[model samples]
Target: MLGVVQTADGLPIHHEVFAGNVAETTTLIPTLTKILKRYPIERVVVVADRGLLSLDNLESLQKMTVGNRPLEFILAVPARRYGEFDTLLEEHHAQHCVGATHEVVGELVWQGQRLIVAHDPEAAATQSESRDKRIEALEQDAERWAGKLVEQETGRSYRGRKLSDAGVTARFYKAVTDAHLGHILKVALNSKDFEYDLDEKALKRARMIDGKLLLVTNMPDYSPEEIVSRYKSLADIERGFRVLKSEIEIDPMFHRLPNRIRAYAMICFLALVLYRVLRMRLKAKNSPYSPNRMLEVVRRIQHHQVTLHRKQSAKGLTTLTPEQKDLFDTVNLPKPSKIAL
Candidate 1:
């Protein structure tokens, strides 16, 4: 359950996964080693969400650092551990600052490089709104369930299932069968109870950090602006994921063997690399064609008729249009021969 993202160019530098278990750290290095063995990646960098905020993981990364230099990392600090980040956020908010990005510099115990912090106001606002919607939806589900619970206790019935007017049976079935629904109700009710203070605090914090986003990176040598920009390059991986999920068919695993799964995935990754190279080339040419459409053109060009005639001398001619010629030139393919008479 971990995804490793590595830069494709030169230096296979990549970041390993966070299995969420300290014991799992041992497995991470080995897993990455296996990938490197087959792929021969150099210059590996690791990036992760806050779920990877583990002292042990940092130590592991430090140990794996090669030749007085360890791997590069872009890791998010947990909100609780974000001491400098919190201060920076407050400073930004206090000034009524809008359309501004903040940067903070620091270091970790295991990492030799200083950590750079970046915050994006607009992205943060969008993310916060999305989170709020999810929380609200969860609360609504819980509230609806709680009302049913009351109905069960009041003697109501559904589809011949005896329930109270408050739907006690309905609530009981829901609580028993759908643990997630039950948990949401528990959380919603507890928000009212004020035992954990989680609900109130969550709502408060969401409002407080309305337009703030935080990202911390160990690439201290680079400017905060550059770090933030590079970190956002992870968006490229989303395109790769779409290709894997939609075109490469990583899911619906037909084989049972683990090796087969790994092999299939690796092959898909290779295909994606080639696809990306072609995509970058097409983009450079400013070709007004989607990758799929470009691929269709390639397929068509491959089958393009090339007639050959044998007489005193052998000769061949190919039928290709000006547009096809332009595409071939852009892709660095040889121009087709003229059609044979």
Candidate 2:
């Protein structure tokens, strides 16, 4: 799934699901092209995770530059890709940010454009702590399972219960304890599978790798703070995915035919658009109403029954509260009928 996030404001403007084989370099440019064609947008800055980062991908964006107007991108990088990146950790003095220590690394030309690297210290620290906890938890879990494994494998009566030695359970348990300790150790150490690290060295390296993530961007004008903030804000679209799948019932598509699936998705997207519109309108009125709340209100209004008693002329009337009237007006709908049904 691809998310085209708005940077000036936190809103997901476009989204699409694509085939797995299509590279980001191939998909990203066309996606931006289509968005620009349809929407009156300018100089879009695409942000993506580390999976989208590649020298080729960066050059693709660079080649799109026309007459000094280049596409802006903020993408995460793997620190191991550069030895210079490791040097930054020690020499760079971090500028205090929102709970993160940020150091604005000078612009370096990459793929024909000067790219900025923002290094954050506190994130590395927090990441290190989190990795340590996770590794410790994994070790504890493995040890706990190893004991049960040994008992089952040996078929020894523990506390007087007959344990079957030649059963599926026995085999499974034996595999757990007898499996390569190196694999388990590697996981606990947070090092690559084949890389060797002594216990203390492993712990230290784990802290360094865990606590750090990288964001690389060609947009020189954007400050380090804005890059971090906007890149993280992509989580907003992730939240939208949950709302689309669960709240809006977009997934588990009840259709079998490909065309039918497309139709179903379109309908769900339309519903999402309407819900967004209602939410935006309510927010304009300073209403602390969410999309679901606004939907409930509109549903009641939609189901409102009006009784028309034809007096001298046939006219229409609707039972509408003042609040409903204001809401309807805000949404640019026709005023509730004055003529009673």
Candidate 3:
């Protein structure tokens, strides 16, 4: 697994390479240990998404000491598992923000820990609409399966591989799982028919907290808004990851040994570093070009070579466009030269 740490402005601080099978939650502590030993950061609060939050990881962060004090953290709560926070959220919302149309921020005690909830009415509407659509589609699929099974029982026949009960159960459950409705819908499979049980309570709870984002923080000094904002900044690091995957294409490895993989990861990490730095520079300059666009502009300035007498070569460079020149200046790089240095 490749984990990268970045600053608030999204420039990469460092990256860690681990065995690909390592659990994401388990990597945070080790990665932070290395970063503390290397960087000169005096105060630190780890802001991570829900995927990296585990009870063990949270406990480790709570016990970890930076210098003379315990580590601070703001982590996202997996609110989709609404059983853990449904009542707390209802109480918090009822007592604090009722009928809030925009974002409503509130806090409550969850098993003696501070649970920060941010409710976006707009997001709630979107989530509810999306879930309703998916559930509707799932119900239609279930009906279609029921019709097919009935046809089979009624002595109707067709081509293509017959749909077995096993296959239908697998397919229906997969569709339900892909839609993230497993908690609300249970596949009731029998040898003869495909049916499902809907957990009304789970469905109600999901709708109750559709757009609610739960965050937990141990930083006593930080406010709820601060915790939420810091956690949102993690999106920048996620963007960096997408850049590594799509633009850099770092996968499809042929290496069998660990050390070679590490070297390749380091090289890709350096390239990611450069890409982020360029992005920062371009943003600061208010340039209209993205890093990818800047690269495209740079690529446009091709070089031409001509062989002269005495086997000497003369080179010529295409004239730089105005946008291309501004891109070069923004990136703090010299223009390409026709003459060999």
Candidate 4:
């Protein structure tokens, strides 16, 4: 599913469900086209993650027009291509950016579009620490595997048949591959002898791009900071998806037909809409309770039947707590009646 969430309000304005096999990158243009046709939007600024911002999708978005006005976008560039922004990173440190946790460097024209580069010191530090830990762990794993290989080579312990040099090398390769440690480690095999070493060159290159991010956009008037902010708002869309799949329990769908699946998705979407409305109301009123807490309070206001004088009385509701009352008032929802048929 592709969701287009509004940055200003964090509401899902549009969504599309593709086949299970369809790639997320391929859905970007089609989803945007559907949204444009459905809404009377004169100008648009699309914000998306790196996975949805391929070169083809970027070109397509550039050429899109709404009533002769071109569409705008703030798309994140993949961090793997960090070398292209070396000059920008150097220039960013010299600039004075007050009250900002990140530094936005000037824009450059790339592939006929403006590219904005930003650096976050905190993010860089966190990423560097994480990478260092992974490298250390991989080194330890390499040492353990080397010891096992030695045991196999020597006549210390044997389980049935002994492993060949190729077998030992293959086993080590599989282990590192499973752990995703192949990038930082190199393995060598020489006829009954094997060795594993850290790939220092790759680790050094990764460190350079630790805290840097690149953003591509077609908006000429938007500053680098604004572009970065807009792109960061893409997280709102991701949060909406989480709400659908987790909070709303939209997954593990048992529907067998395509139409049924689509209907279920729509139901989840509507539930998200209602949830956001209540959330916004509570937030506007400065309420300190979360949606789940409010729901729990509401759930506590249950009803039960009573019998009186050989006659069955209507259901009677429990009294609401002060917190529940405050929540209802903040959300502008009327309290339930004490009794109901």
Candidate 5:
């Protein structure tokens, strides 16, 4: 599923489901086209993560137009491209504060975009600590695996029971592949015997780019701080997805038909829209309660029925706390009242 969330309000504008086998990059254009058509806005600035920031997608976005005005974009560049801005990174680091995110802005005329690169010292410290822990764990596991290989080679009781070279290689690869430590780990295999060691140079290079984020945007008129702020808002889209998958229960769908699946997604999208609206209302009013808390309080307000002489009927509402009343007022909703009918 591909979801295009509006950055202004952090609500889903459109969503589309592709075949499970299709790559997320492949769905970007199609999903975006649907959004442009549905919204019919004169201008838009797309904010997306690195996963959707392919060269082809960037070029296509450069050419796209809405009512003859070119579309703008704020896309995240992957950390793998960190070397491309080494000079800028150094310049920024020179002026970087001890615990602040200092922005180093630059332009690439050939690429037709401005770069807003940020370095956060606190974030770097956190990332470095986490990486060190993971590396330590990886090293310990690699040593254990190497020891097992040695046992298999030296144990006479298991002469024919030793693992094959392929098995040992597979185990080594599996250990390092998804751990993001493959580049730093050197694995050697000889028949059933295996050995692994950390490459310090590679580890140092990886750590150099920690806590650095590169934001590229065609909207150069915006200040670096503005660009960084807009890019950070992309987290709202991620949060919306989490809400759909968790609070809205958009997954584990039992529908079999494509139309039914699409409908289910639409329902979830509507629920998210409503959720955002309520959230905005609360935020605007500076309400202290969260949406969930307010909902819980409202849910406790029940209605009761009373009958007199088997003909007269009256409807009465449960007592509303001051907090509940404040919530209703914040949302511009009327409080439930008793009625005689």
Candidate 6:
């Protein structure tokens, strides 16, 4: 397994390989240890999604320190999972409501821990719309599945898995769970077909916290807005990973030796560093082409060479297009020459 760590500015800082048996969540400790040992930054804040932090991990992190100072962290919390927060959330919404699409709705002390809650109306709307669409499609699927019962009554059958009551229940539940609406969707299995119901109360509860983001943090000096901003920097980290997987093709390794695998990973990491540097350079110059796109354009330019029987060989680069020349100028890179060295 491979792990990568990056900064808020979309720059990769560290990477490591792990045994296949190592759970992804367990890699955090070693990765952070290596990072802290190598960089020795005085103030370090680990910001991550809810999936990364267990209760034990949080406790361990709270105890971890650097240079005699405690390490800080901003972690997302599943607010809805904590029913105790419902009353507090209602109060928070009532007292700190704002008209903006997104805002820090409230900052409350829960279990003596600082919890900053934010709301995003746009995100909420998108989520609500998605759920509604999925539910609608699910209803349509139910109707079709029920129609099979009618066919069964008339002695008609299809050439796939035979439709059974148990199969219908299992299949429909799988779909519900896949859509994450298991709480809101209800199903009844019968000998004929299947019946399902939408739990209005459960759905209302789900919709209430659609875009509500709750963050738990140990950084006392930072404000709610600042905490939210740090958590949002996760986007840049994700972008770094995306660039590695898509552009560098870091996976599907064909190597047999461990050292060669590490070498490949190191090369990929270096390539990522160079890629980001080129990206920054292009952005600084306001170039229209991305580094990947720029490479595509430049690769089109070719060098031609011809030699006479007894004379020195002649070599020249193909003519550079206006776009290619402008790109080179924008990036301050010297264009290749046809002159033989």
What range of 10 consecutive residues in model 1 has the weakest lDDT sum?
188-197
| Top-TM-score structure, candidate number | 3
Tell how far residue 267 is off in model 3, in angstroms: 1.3
Error of 1 at 29 (Å): 2.9
Taking all chains together, the TM-score of candidate 2 against the true structure is 0.65
- Score each candidate by Cα lDDT: 0.55, 0.58, 0.82, 0.74, 0.74, 0.82
Order by TM-score, highest first: 3, 4, 6, 5, 2, 1
- Candidate 2 lDDT at 14 equals 63
Report each candidate's C-alpha RMSD, comma-separated, in the order given.
7.1, 6.8, 3.0, 3.6, 4.0, 3.5
lDDT of 2 by residue, 42-75 (tens): 5777778777878888778767743358877888
Q: What TM-score against the true fold does each predicted structure earn?
A: 0.62, 0.65, 0.87, 0.85, 0.81, 0.84
lDDT computed for candidate 2:
0.58
> Candidate 6 on 44-144: residue-level lDDT in tens?
89988878766888888888887888989888987667777777777666565435555545688876779998888788788989999999998888788
Tens digit of per-residue lDDT, candidate 3, span 1-341: 88888877888878878887888877788888998999887888888888867677777888888888788888888876536677677667676555778898777777567888888888888988999999999999888887887798788876887776778888999999998899888997664556688899888777778778888887788788877888888888889999989888888777889889888888988999899889988888888889888887788888889887888887788888888877788878897766672
TM-score: the better of candidates 2 and 3 = 3
Model 4 lDDT at residue 30: 72
Angstrom error at residue 135, model 5? 2.1
The regions of model 3 sitting more than 4 angstroms off are: 94-98, 144-174, 190-195, 308-312
Clashing pairs in 3: none
Q: After superposition, how far is residue 98 of candidate 5 from its true place, in Å?
A: 9.6
